[model samples]
Target chain A: MMTQFVIRRVLYMIPTLIAVSIVTFLVIQAPPGDYLTTVVARLEAEGQYVDRGQLDALRERYGLDESVWVQYWRWITGIVLHGDFGQSLVYSAPVSDVIQERLGLTILLSVTTLAFVWAVAIPIGMYSAVRRYSVGDYAATFVGFIGLAIPNFLIALILLYVSYRYLGQSVGGLFSPEFVDARWNLGKVLDLLAHLWIPVVIIGTAGTAGMIRVVRANLLDELNRPYVVTARAKGLPERRLLIKYPSRIAASPIVSTVGWLLPSLISAEIIVSVVLSLPTTGPVMLRALESQDMYLAGSFLLVLSVLTVVGTLISDILLARLDPRIRYGRR
Target chain B: MVESPPPLLDVRDLRTHFATDTGMVTAVDGASFSVPRGKTVCVVGESGCGKSVTGRSILRIVDAPGRVVGGSILWDRDGTGDPVDLATLDPGGPDIRKIRGDEIAMVFQEPMTSLSPVHTIGSQIAESVRLHTDLDDDAVRGRVIEVLGQVGMPRPESRYDAYTFQLSGGMRQRAMIAMALVCHPRLLIADEPTTALDVTTQAQILRLMVQLQAEMDMSVLFITHDMGVVAQIADEVVVMYLGTVVETGPTEQIFTDPRHPYTRALLQAIPRFGQRRAGRALSIIPGSVPDPYRRPGGCPFHPRCAQARPGTCDVVEPATVTVAERRDVRCVLAAEEVHS
Candidate 1:
């Protein structure tokens, strides 16, 4: 029954994605700038273009000389079947290759952040709400408020400074000094982690604070729910009440929102990745935009959207399985 | 009739209050009651009368900002008649949680919210069993099927694995009962257990509870606003008003020859079939429960008591004068009315 529903949903996503690709192609084309002209003109200035025949042949090959509708149709068809996102105007690489190379870095960072966020925030939030006005709860709330106030990039800069001055080491730039000499092994991994600690802590601190507040508020509300009180009356142990009831109900909404959590993750990474000069998607996207690297930039955007949609879809499926009320069509 | 033993739960002078930003609000103010083994005691009152708070206070599940300032919840572990004061025990203390499910289990209202929507009912019920026992998987599964059958759920073998949402309201209530009584707890605290069910389901659930109690010889502390339910199941009745136990006695005596005016007024409020308060609406108690923040210094129910003497009733909190064996009422007029 559940599998049928998921299969149906996956089938439905096909047309929606086709529509998204068409929209992506048109929007990029309709914007009054033609990036291909600049590349061609720059090459011409360097005495690369010989005559009208050569220029026209080059334009036809990339589909720039064709009608806008024809070019769009060709691109759409390529994406739908062959999964070809087209070649880059500036970087001159296939769009998928660009996405492939950068996606791992972004996922590595975000997933790590996700783990730290939940682990630290849940306890802080639970105890804070449970304690309500105790010194610890208030202190945690105050710290969370600091994360809300300070911009993440500014925090990143401060962490970098701390690593350089206090620790007398350059850490925020990814891999430590040893990895510069050594290769990818146990020692290199440990060295990278040590140096990455400052940025991870800074970025993670703010992320953790946000999650802590979210978990705290959600948990507090769930605790006051009549069901929670009922669980208490049943003479269930404190451990049972917390783990079984409040945790699940309180977490549902946040869990449902995970698919959409990427924008914040990407935006947060932009500054941190830039400041540290990490070869992540944020920096790649920025450089692609500056150089009018159309294929790379477009490919990055497509990958991001797919990741978000897929994430949300996964969350929905899991939620349906966890909850009987979700109606996964028990057939 | 086979007489039951002494009360399983003996609460005395239960004073609970919240030290909120707005000074102190008395929640379960100086209330007292007893629930004998193998029987039901229904605590009935309007909302804000501290009926629910009294039940939670016994379990020490009162969330922060609300504390059990002073009280005694003397609970008997078995037929030994030795009562343990639960009010003095720390909420996180080992002794309390250890006995919570094994000896005393609670069935919360609204099976939907009480049962985790994420898990199967069998898994949830198994939690109570696993917490205090060392049963293997097959043993736990066998026990789950047995309890489901005991609660009168149809095809218990198949339904134990279902989640709360898959079951009907009546079935959910039974599942909740199954969860609470699965361990065969000596005492069960049922707070508004049937309020969420339909009339037919309520009757069935109540009867099932009574049957289970007789079979297991367990004590039940049933809290509800429905006097009809109270009349049906309760062996003893406690009438609460403004955080105080206004009247408490055997159910038959309290219903038939209600001594306290509040009890009389409450019974009178219960709708009859026809021609009973002819062409008149239910006689409201004239006023709502007093605000705990601005409570009367004397008898808390004086403002709403129809027979209250203006000066005297409003000036002094009456002592719980004994009217019969195991029957006491915290009302000055009980004696006066009896003599009259």
Candidate 2:
């Protein structure tokens, strides 16, 4: 039964990705003119006489002269058949290469941030719920409210300044200048770890705070449930009773929302990444869109859409595993 | 008849209060009763009368903002050992933890919500067994299955892995009963265990509980508002009003010779079979249970009691007056009978 459900869900993602790709292609193309226009306009602004012949040649070279349907067809087929995302007009390189350069760091940052969020949120949420209205609960709530109210970029700026002023060290980017383009080594990895905290903390603050509230509210609801009382009556130690029952039940909502996290890996915290000077895909995607680098921008969005679909599938599977009610499709 | 065994659990002047935002609301106030060994005692009351809280106080399982403020839950585990005052033990301490499921276990009213939805029936039942016994995994599973079968769960072996939501209401209650009974507790406090089931299911569950009480030789403190259910399963009946036990006696005596005005009113309120006539409203107590925060100064039931005397019942609380063997009633009229 489980395998069948998973198989059906996987099959459904095909048409979903196709629909998402088409929408992505059209939206990227919907803006006025093409990447060539932006390039020509820039060259003209630089006071260079751009002849119409050179402009037409450049347009034809990049397949910009093709109809929208033909261009979309070519791009989609290339991605399907060759695992190619086409050449990025802005970088003068393949869109795949541009993304690949940052993909590892982006995934690392996102996974670490998610790990930090869950590790910090679940315990504090459980504490706040089990010891509800106590001193610690109040303090956690106050801090959580502040975290939720402040934007991530502002948090990034504050951390940067704090490190510079108090710690007497500049904490920005995923690596120090000495290791920015250094070859992979233990020293560079260590430096990466040292600088990783700032971005992870800033980006994770809002999510951790939000998740704490989610867990606290969900746990609080579950704690008051008769099952919890029943467990207590069974002489299960308080901590075990909490973790084994309400906490597990409370985690369902968190697992169900994990689908949103995948796309957020590349698109979320754009301003924070820019502020911290981190080498992540958010800034790259932003620049691609601004420069009307259609291939690069479209590829970024297509990957994000695909991640969203796959993320939803992953979350559904996880939820099914976590909750038998969902696994058996019973009410 | 065989002489009644010594009481398995004797509760004395139990006062459990909840510290709500407004003020301390005493849910169970100076209520007293006893559950004799191997018999069923039903605590009958309207909502907010603190029958459930009284049961929780005995088990020391009252939730946050609520606590057993003053009570002596004397648990005589084997009818030979000196009774231990459960109220004196720290609710979170190890001694109480050992006693909670090992010697005294409780089943809650909402079978739908009382069993963890994420856990399988066998695992939940096995939890208590594993906690109180040194049983291996296989033995624990064996004990759980045995209790599940005892509770009349259909095909206990196949149903072990079923989640609570997969079971019918009756089946879930049986699972709950199995969980409580897995430890072979001396006292089983069931707080309205069948109130949420359909009438047919309720009858089945009641019958099952009664049979289990006999087979396990365990005392049951059953809390419910259903007087009909009291008639069906109760050996002794304790009628409570606004956190106080107003009457206590054998079920037949409480039904036929109710002393307290509130108990009389409650018995009158029960709809008898073939007694309903078209166009006539079913019998009911005159007023709802009084708000706990704003309890009446004198007798809590004075505002609702049919025979309440303005000067006496409204000015002074009645004391428990023993008018017959092993029967007690708290009423000014009953007090007058004793004095006269």
**Highest TM-score model number:** 2
Top candidate by lDDT: 2
Docking class of 2: high
lDDT of 1 by residue, B237-265 (tens): 99998899988989999999887788888
Local error of candidate 1 at A69, Å?
A: 4.5
lDDT of each: 0.79, 0.86
Candidate 2 residue spans exceeding 4 A from truth:
A35-66, B1-5, B274-281
* DockQ for every prediction shown: 0.53, 0.81
Model 1 misplaced regions, further than 4 Å: A33-35, A45-57, A76-87, A92-103, A175-191, A202-205, A233-236, A327-331, B1-5, B276-281, B336-340
lDDT of 2 at B19: 96
lDDT of 2 by residue, B1-340 (tens): 7876668888899999999999889899999888888888999988989888888888788988899888798888877758899989999888899998888899888988888888898899888988898989999888888888988988999999999888999999999898888888988989999889999998998899989989988888889999888988999999998899999999999888888888888878777666765555678887787777888988889898778889888899888888887799988898998999
Residue A107 miss distance in model 1 (angstroms)? 3.5
Query: Model 2, range A97-157, lDDT digits (tens) per residue?
Result: 8999687788788889888888999889989998999999999999999999998888888
